[model samples]
Target: MIARARLIGVVGFLIAGATGLISSTQTWLLVSLSDGAAEPLAVAGASAVVLLAPLSLTALALGAALSIVGRILRPVFGVIGAVLGIALAILTAPIAIQAPVSAVSAEVAAVTGIRGESAIAELVAGITATTWPAITLVAAVLMAAAGIWVLATARLWPEGGRRYQSERAERRRSGGPLDAIDSWDDLSRGGDPTT
Candidate 1:
């Protein structure tokens, strides 16, 4: 059970790491492609780190939850939550980060008559300007919240013997042996196979 949860958690972490990198890179790519494209401030420090932070945290949380819960808890909700949260994060990161970046760009453009990624700047302005993007932002925030809730629910959800058995089987096939670990009887008998 613990083995299965660990496996799922590790896979979740890997997926989160990979996707986080891609999204973070894309954020920079979007920024770089903007008018002037004059490297954004602290590209490595701010952009990459900020973007990757959520994914890493989410992954860690999921892994920890799964491991703690063992096979009793499934990661399906975590997966869904992560997918939605990641999508919302990816969508809104630019909105959140770029909006400020755009403000700076606008000021710079106003002063120097140089536009770096004017299109992106305009988008930033448009996003931050008024009701439209604000509404979208709110929705994105709601979605992220829902995703978090989903993850939490997944963590707290209970499991039946069937779920435990399947998860244990999965673990046995992958990393550990089936017989090495005791079944429900072991739990009742107060035996610890992992020890």
Candidate 2:
């Protein structure tokens, strides 16, 4: 169960982060102009939520770090992940529910050279949300659940391996004789291997 929990937490965060990053580059809303332009203006997730890409990157980093960090840091990372998930949800939920005129202001400005909230609102005939926002919301929920899972099962996870420890530390712990590799390591560190 411990191993399964660890796997779940790691995999869940990874998938959620990847999906969120991908969705951030996708269209989240379509804005129709009151003037009846041939095509509607597209508002990307990144424009709608500027923090989306950064938050997703953080989630990816957190997932990678969680796999190798010791028990002490697990809960800390878990808390960060939970907060990130909630933040993402908070930023995305409003746009998903009803995209405000400000959400498409950038696209409108770029296309029609119109600026300001009122100006963009005047040009926008309707705002329709795309599927990307829904997908991002689901990913946010999964990320939060994975974080909570980590917090609950951190103590049950196995202790981190000592593979990253220096050979001298390993030898001291095991009381083993120094090997050729240890001699090379000592030499590389400006120590007298003969000593």
Question: After superposition on all CA atoms, how large is the RMSD of candidate 2?
Answer: 3.7
By TM-score, the best candidate is: 2
Writing each residue's lDDT as its tens digit, candidate 1 over 42-94 gives: 22212423435465455446545554554334446455545755564565555
Each model's lDDT comes to 0.46, 0.88
For 42-133, candidate 2 gives per-residue lDDT tens digits of 88999989999999999999999998888899999889888989999998888888888877888888889888889788889999999899
lDDT of 1: 0.46
- The most accurate candidate by lDDT is 2
Worst 10 residues of 2 by lDDT: 159-168
RMSD (CA, Å), candidate 1 to true, equals: 11.2
Clashing pairs in 1: 34-117, 35-116, 35-117, 36-116, 36-117
